[model samples]
Target chain A: MANKIFLVIQREYLARVKKRSFLLATLITPLIFPTILGLFLWVGMSDTVGENRKVIEVVDENNSFFLESNELYSFSYSELGQEDAKLLVQEGLRFGFLYIPKLDIQNPKGIVFYSEETPPISMITNLEASLQSKMESLRLQASGIDPLLLSAFKTNVDIQSIIVSEAGGERISNSVVNYAIGFLAGILIYTFIFVYGNQVMQGVIEEKSSRIIEILVSSLKPFQLMMGKIIGIGAVGLTQFLIWILLIGLVSSLVMGYFGMKMPQQQMLEMSAQQGLFPADGNPEIVEILQMIQGLDFVQITLTFLIYFVGGYLLYGAFFAAIGAAVDSPSDAQQFMFPVTIPLLVAYMGLFIFVLDDPNSNVSFWLSIIPFTSPVAMMGRVSFGVPWHHLALSISLLVAGFLSTAWLAGKIYRIGILVHGSKVNYKVLWKWLKQN
Target chain B: MEILSIRSLNKSYGSHVALKDFDLSVSKGKIFGLLGPNGAGKTTLIRIVNQIIDKDSGEIYINGQALKMDHVRNIGYLPEERGLYKGMKVKEQLLYFAQIKGLRKQDAKQKITNWLEKLNLSQWKDKKIQDLSKGMAQKVQFIATVIHRPDLLILDEPFSGFDPVNAEIIKNEILELRNQGVTIVLSTHRMESVELLCDEIAMINRSKKILDGTIQTIKEEAKTNVFRVKMIPDSMEYVPMGEELRRQDGMLEFKLELKDQKPNELLGMLMSKGEILGFEEIVPSIEEIFIQKINESHGE
Candidate 1:
């Protein structure tokens, strides 16, 4: 039986990979995502060039330092008459004009901006941030406190999490690994359910609508045909997935090398600084990330993700194949799809709220051990440094889930593939599921 | 020896009986025709024999043994509806089906090559089924069905969608397979093909076999005993005496007055009145026989 199934798998995989659509999608889909991202970035960045006009003249009699940085729009200091600036605003020579009447010397508004069109949010934010920093310095000086002493009041609070295990030694910051595992698990499960479920539905619809099932059901069993199709299409999907992963890896490396060469080292450093993270110096978070990635515990997280990703995909794939056999049309399948997909959706919700909230919490432990949601939840927990015994239990549950779902799906698939013309309801599906 | 036999078969689509107490047998090497109108339970019976659909009650025997999984490998079925996957290339589709039918890759490839060459589909080997014309696709489907070389072949509406030339090509192929000692059961509405190819036949209607026999025997049995006679028109008055049907091409045709009529008396009367020019009997075509049988059966 295994050999026969493998033969079918080989045929399906080879046939689909050679298809124009599969080849196109494999080569094109990844490029499409990155291209779309780059396009949006380019559009946003282009709006900044050759388009700056708005300016506000600040007449600060108190010599208050204000508006810094020209990231959004360039600012130029001008000693001009208020009437002249007003005329310029009316004539559309300048976008707008602003004047600070006076600061209260105790409680000050400090700065104001004016614009015909509401000044871009980035520009307003930059101005407000610069003015606030300067005001804090002045306020410190007015209070007769040393500005350096005021800056020195910043307290460094750095936490180093540690995990000690009976089987394994000490670990640090397993939270990131656990969350990454969980996210990976959820993504794999979601992808399989959506992808294979529709394949089954489309396969059923194709056979039923074409009336080929009428003849096919005669020679072989309906169950046999359904199994063949699910296995066949699954093989096709797996082939495409493997190809896509390989292609994406290749493309990513090429892009990284090309962009790395093109970008100046200083600009790269500055960009990282702006995001509040920098490597080699200044920011400790980047150094921690690099360290964590190299740690022994990261190996465990990688291994767990690999196992759960495949297990979760196959588990959900079985249900998808079963649903496909049961429904007459894709639209009709949607009625049953909600209940079928609920577990995966609920798992995602569980990860977001309970598992990610407290990876070591009782809720995360239970959710991670449950077969239906374990693939994702367990991965999430792993990142948070879960115990070895829990990891074993989660893997076992995932395996059990795959086998049981495959059995159930095979049963339903056998009967449902031959049935057509009427809507398949819960009542009928239950009967099929129960039939010997 | 009989190649296939289906006895006391019964099937239903819900409350409506599609086949009831239907029995049929096809002998080895004979091209057997099954004639029936639409909704006459013909397709239902074929489906049961193929085991595509299960019968509510029946025993189907092949080669004097009970039907089993291996029986399918020995039987070739060309269904009424086209079953080729349109997305697959013609050669690839044939090979896939051939593989499913228990042919090895090498064997399937060899057979596919030969079949493609024979069918003049060599150039279209790599063409998708959807790209082929309906006739070409049908031919590809035929090749797939016959690729495994089953002893028993069942074809439903085998000539549907073919032009006269292609129909004749298929007809000859069907005959050639029969000549090679393959038993065939063909279900079709074209009575002309039945007349040309079928030596024996059984027709089903309304869940029952209404007629079954050799072509010669059934035609002989269904004869009306009508005759056409031509003389010097001395029979103008006697035509009424013999239930005169009509005159055609200067010949008088009539049905024998079966009440008290004597053939010798009628002949003597015709001889005495005028010289006998020509006389012959008229046999009904299969089309006429089918129509008459259906109408009479319904009326009864």
Candidate 2:
């Protein structure tokens, strides 16, 4: 039986790996991320359309406000009436106009932006920030303080999060890095389960539809065949993922080197500093980001990811296989698929709502402990630092969940693989499950 | 020696019984015919022997040993609804099956080459199964079933998709395998082939075996004590005391009631009046016996 299972796995793996479609998908999927990123960067860097700068006319009734202009837009202060500014905007003389009415210093109101198209949020935010700063300086002057001196005294505070371990010394923690790691790992497991679990189900449906399953079951038990398929396809997914990581890393680095571009880690550090997470004195050090990444317990998180990936796939893959066996065609599988997909969908939603928002929250804790949601939700929390005991409990429950689902699926698979030419429903499946 | 034996095996699916107290045995080197109409328990019995489905109750023995997973290694099954991996190359598919049946890789490769050559399929070795014609694919399915040289071969409707020439080839191979001491359980609706190949037969209907015995014995049991005689024209003055059923091609076919009289007594009376050109008792064909038995059971 063991040898037979090995043969089955070998056949499944080899058959898929040798297909042109598999090769194309595996090779192209990883490149998709870098490709989209490159496209966005190219579009941003290249300004082919030589259009006039967006002009905005500012009408300050009190004549106490001034706004600056950037490359994409030009602001012109005017003594023109509000009605005249609106008419100019209507005639396409300006992109829009900002009207500032005389306001109480403490409670300013009636500041409105009018545009032919809805202005971008960033534009509105920039305008609002400029106005608020000007108003603050004016208020400082009214209190008989030097506005320049007040600006000179302003200093940005940067908080460094550090974790002191019993054996290892203090290590800096970056919430941004932790969130990115958790989000990526959680999504990776979710994608793997969806992709390879479908492969297992499709393989079963193909064998059943082709009528090869009867011959297969003759020599090997149904459970062995099902497990062989699940494990085999899982290995294929792992192989694809590993290859994608290696090839994407190689190709992106080569391309970036050719373009004289900094690595993604350096770029992410710059982005973090630009987001005001670091002091604005100079460029943020790359070593700090690297240290924060190293401070994360990646070994633990990666190991847990692997465990949950396999456990989740086996649990869901069993249900997928059973659904595949129970239905006669791909079209017939949809009705059964909804219920099976519900748990996965819930886990995904819960990961975003509870785990990513606050990993230590009660909702996140419960979702991580539950076997169905834990594969995604737990990984989402792992990078945020989960309790050791909770992780162990989740892993144990997931294993038990996989085993029970496998047994149940084996029952349905044993009977359903042989059944044909009938509309199998939940009632029929229930009867099949009830049988020995 | 019985290579495969089943005793009082029973199986049911929900309220529908597929096999009930079914007993069968295929002796070594004999072709055992599992005859039945469509929807009879013949497939169910074969599936049990192949261990494809578990029997609800009963015992299955292979070579006098209780059946186990290892027993599957000795049995080859060609199912009624047969197919190969359509997208897989013929050689690779056959090798995969051979390996699954427990052959080592090198052994499977060698055997696959041999089977491909023997079946005149070497030219199509690299072709996907879907590329082959129906008859060619059926031949490949047969090779996959037998590539491991199993001791017991169970073929359900083995010739369903084959043309006559291909069917004949497979029929000859089955006989050759039987001659080499392989026990065969053949379940098919083609009774003519059963008459040609089967040594013993069992007919199943409605999940039960209604008739079973050696082919000759079953035929004998179904006989009506009828005889056909051909005599020289106009040589007899008085006819034998029997109902003259028909006269065709210079043969007088008659039905006899030998309640107390011996067959030789009637033969003596016929010989005195005419030259006995041909004389032989008539026995029913398997097809006739099958229908008659089924009708009798249905009547009861």
Candidate 3:
């Protein structure tokens, strides 16, 4: 049986590997993937990439409000009337005209800004924030507090989170870093399950529609055929991913080198920042991002990710194979696909609403524990630090889930592949399953 | 010794009975024809023998041993609904089938080259199955089935998609393989092939065997004990002992039942009536027997 299955796997792997599409996808994905990511990054981080900051002509009647200049906009306080400042904006001399009229400080009415284009809410919020703080200080001064001392007492508080291992090792941590890892790992598993799981389904359908299924089953046990196919297609997926990893790594390093980008030194600097060995840099986020990345438990994340990756693919792949065997064609597969797709959708949505928001939430814990949802949901929680016991429970359930699904799918596949009925339904599938 | 034996094997799907208490034994190195109308459980029986599906009850034995997973390697089955991977090359596909049936790679490669050459497909070995014609593809499927040189070959409608010339070629190939002592189970609706090739046959109707015997025994059992005679009449009014079935050029054909009369007695009576041009006992063909068996079962 083992040797027969190996032969089948060899055939499946060779058949797929020799396809033109497989070669094209394997070779081009690394290039297109980075290009797409770069496009998104260039579009998403427009501010940091240096677009011109708009200037706002400010007409402060009381000279009381002094707003800060930032990357998006700069404020120029001009001794001019509100109408003149508005005229300057209308003539395109300035991007905006901010009129801070002399009013009762308590009520603070008739404050407006004029611009040819509507300002973003974030810009308006920024202007409101600085003005609100200034008004608070003025009100405190009205209560006879010394303004200089009030300013001196206004120091912002920041809390740094440190994750301490039971053995007393400490590592600086950030929720954003956990969120990013969780998001990436979850999406990767989700796509992998869909991509390769569907490939298994398509393979079964191909064998059936081509009328080679009975010929195959006659030569080998249906379970062996199913298992061989799943493993074979999975090997293809793993091969493609390994190639992508190598090519992407090689390309990125070369490009980074070409641009004189230092990575190891950057990681070192991030490690030092984690130790607070250097003073805060010009932008605190630079130090914080690197430190959070450096403190990540990647070894744990990688091993767990791999387990879920294979476990999830196997678990879902069996059902896809069963569906393919039960149906006559891809169209017939639609009716049976929902039972598999819904749980994945739940896991995907639950990753954001429950796991990513608060990994310790009861919903996240249950989602990560349940076999159907764990492959995706657990990845979202693992990066956020799941308890070992919980992790163990989830992995065990996933294995059991795969075994049970394989058994069920094996039953369906053995019977379904030989019987080609145009009207195969749940009742027929249930009958097929219950026969043994 | 029996190359394959199935005893009291019963199988069902839900409330539908596909095979019930089916018993069969195929002698080694002989072609056993499994004849049945559509939906008569022939496929079910074949599938059970192949162990592609389980028997609800009963046992199958091959080479005096109880059937198991390993027995599949010794049995080559060509399903009625059969095909090869369209995208796969002929040689590669044959090798895959051969290896899956337990042939080593070196043996499989040598066998594949020989079979391709034998079928005049040597030049087409590198081409995909989809690129081959229907008859050529069927030939490729045939090679795939026998590439491992299995001890027991089961062919279900093996020549269905082939043209007459190709079918003759495949029939010759099957005969050649049988000459080499490979037991074969031949199943098909083609009675001519059954009559020509089967050493023993079992006719099934509505999931039950209605007739099982060697070709001669089956014909003997199915005989009506009626003689067909053609003669020139002494007189237009003179009638024979039997009813005239046809007449042409002053000669009349008659069917005479041999009821309570010896052959000499019947011939003596016919001789006095007219000159006998031709006289012979009517032996039924397998096609007639097949139709008769199915009709009788349907009547039941």
Candidate 4:
């Protein structure tokens, strides 16, 4: 049986890897192709649009405004008349003409911008903010009050969160960091499960449509075939992911090297700071953020992620295979998708609503403990920090859930692969399950 | 020796019985034709033997041993809805099937090459099955079925999609395999092929074995001992105790039942009444027997 499964796995792996779409998707999917395309686009755009900064000619009636200039746009205050500024813009000497006719401060009106194209909203909004503040200060001055006192009332407040571990060590922790890790790990599991799970589905459909299921089963059990396919496609998914990481890393670094752009060397900077070569103490928040990141238990997080990643895929992939077997085509598989997706949707929503915000909440506890939702919901809680019992309970339940689902799915798959129908529903699926 | 045997195998889906109290024994080296009307549970029986599905309550033995997973390698089944992976090269697909059935890669490749060449498909081995004609693809499927050289081969409608020339080639190959001491169970509705190739046949109808025996025995069982005699009678008025079928210019054709009479005695009695032109026994074809048996079982 093992040998037969290995043969099946070998065939499935080779068949998919040989397709042109696999290579194309691997190269284009993970930011590598787009990044290279962006590199060329950046180079091309720099020659035309980057070199010429947009210059706006301001014709202020009061001549009291001092407009600031930036790299993408420049402000030119001209004593020239409105008509002359419009003429300058029409003559292509300026990108736009901003005419601010004497504003009645209380009711500012008749401010217009004339350009060949519509001015960006950012440019208009920036101008409005600057002019509004200026008018407010002018109003304050007319009232015989110092605007500096209002500015003195404004101060910056930074709230640094500190967490006291059970071991009695208090450290400044960043929720942003925790959220990032949890979100990344959770979404990765979600994406990998769907992508690879669909691969297993499509593979089953292919075999069924081609009428190879019966012949295959004659040589080995249907369960073995389904498993071989799942494992084989999962291996391919892992292979593609690793290749994307390697290729994207290699190509992006090469491009960055060519342009003499250095990545944020946080580790190098921290090393220098520790060696007293560079004083990162200037930014206390940065030091604390770095330390908090290092303080995270990546070993535990990574281990759980791996366990659930495979576990989640197996759990959902079995259902996907059964669905594929039950339907005649990919389009026909839609009716069966809703039920399978419910648990995933609940887990996804639950991850944000409960797991991330309050991992220890009862709702979060239930979501993590349930096998269907735990693969994703548990990841968020794990990243925050979970009691060992919760982890053990969830993992154990997930295994039981997977075994039962696999058994159920195998029964359906054996019959469904041979069943040809125009319509299949939950009733038919139930009948098939009872057939066992 | 019986290489394949099924005793009182019973299988059903819900209230619908597929196979019930089915019994069959195929000798070591012969093609046993499984004849049945559409939806008569022939495929179900074959599936049970292949263990693709389980029998509700019965026993199936391959080579005098209870059927088990290890017996998979001993059986090569060509399902009615047979197919090769369309996007897969013929050689690659064959190798996969062969290796999965427990053949080493080198030996499988060798056998695949020989089968492909023998089937006039050597030039098409590198092409994907979709690229080949239907007949060419069928040839490839046939090779895959027998590449492992299984002891018992169960083929369901193996000739359904093949053209005459290819079907003949396949028939010859099946015969060749039988000559090599392989037991084959062939399920098809084509009665002429059954008559031409089958050594023994089992007729399944309405989830039951209605008739079964050697091709000759079944045909003989359904025989009427009737003969088609063509003669030039001495006198048209002296008609015998036989139905006149036709009169073709001095030839009197009629059907005569030679029940319990020796061929010589019947010939002697007929010779005196007419100068016998032709005297031939009327035997029922398997097709006729099949239709008759099915209609009898259906009570129509």
Q: Who wins the lDDT comparison?
A: 3
What is the total number of backbone clashes in candidate 3? 0
> What's the CA RMSD of model 4 in angstroms?
4.1
Better by DockQ, candidate 4 or 1: 4
Instruction: Show where candidate 1 strays beyond 4 Å.
Output: A1-7, A32-154, A166-168, A174-181, A192-220, A258-283, A296-354, A360-382, A385-436, B223-241, B247-251, B257-300
Model 3 per-residue lDDT at A100:
86
Which 10 consecutive positions of candidate 3 chain A have the poorest summed lDDT?
A256-265
Between prediction 1 and prediction 3, the one with superior TM-score is: 3
B1-300, model 2: which lDDT tens digit per residue?
889888999899778999988888778889999999999988888888888888899998999999998877799999998789999999999988887888888999999889889999999999999899988998999999999999989999988878999999999999999999888889999899999999999999999999998998998888777777666545434465678776666556565555566779877877876667777887888999999989999998
What are the TM-scores, per candidate, against the unseen true structure?
0.78, 0.92, 0.93, 0.86
* TM score of chain A per candidate: 0.76, 0.90, 0.88, 0.79
Candidate 1 clashes between residue pairs 3 or more apart in a chain or in different chains: A174-A383, A177-A383, A178-A383, A182-A380, A217-B52, A218-B51, A218-B52
lDDT of 3 by residue, B136-241 (tens): 9999999999998899999998888789999999999999999999999989878988999999999887777788888889999999989999888888887767
Q: Once superposed on the true structure, which residue ranges of model 2 sit more than 4 Å away at CA? A: A47-53, A87-93, A104-107, A136-155, A166-169, A264-288, B230-240, B246-254, B272-278
The residue-by-residue lDDT of candidate 1 on A242-309, one tens digit each, is: 77777766665555454453222344456556875545554566456544544446578668866776
DockQ of candidate 4 relative to the true structure: 0.76
Q: Root-mean-square deviation of each candidate, in angstroms?
A: 6.0, 3.6, 2.9, 4.1
- Model 4: native contacts recovered, as a fraction: 0.86
Mark the regions of model 3 whose C-alpha exceeds 4 Å error after superposition. A40-51, A57-63, A76-102, A113-118, A254-285, A288-291, B268-274
Q: For each candidate, report its DockQ versus the true two-chain complex.
A: 0.29, 0.82, 0.85, 0.76
In model 2, how large is the Cα lDDT of residue A420?
Answer: 89
Q: Which residue pairs come into collision in candidate 3?
A: none
Ranking by TM-score: 3, 2, 4, 1
Of candidate 4 chain A, the 10-residue stretch with the lowest lDDT total is: A261-270
Residue-wise lDDT of candidate 3 within A17-129, one digit each (tens)?
Answer: 99999999999989886666556655656755546678899888888889888877888998988788889999988999888889788899998989999988988898898
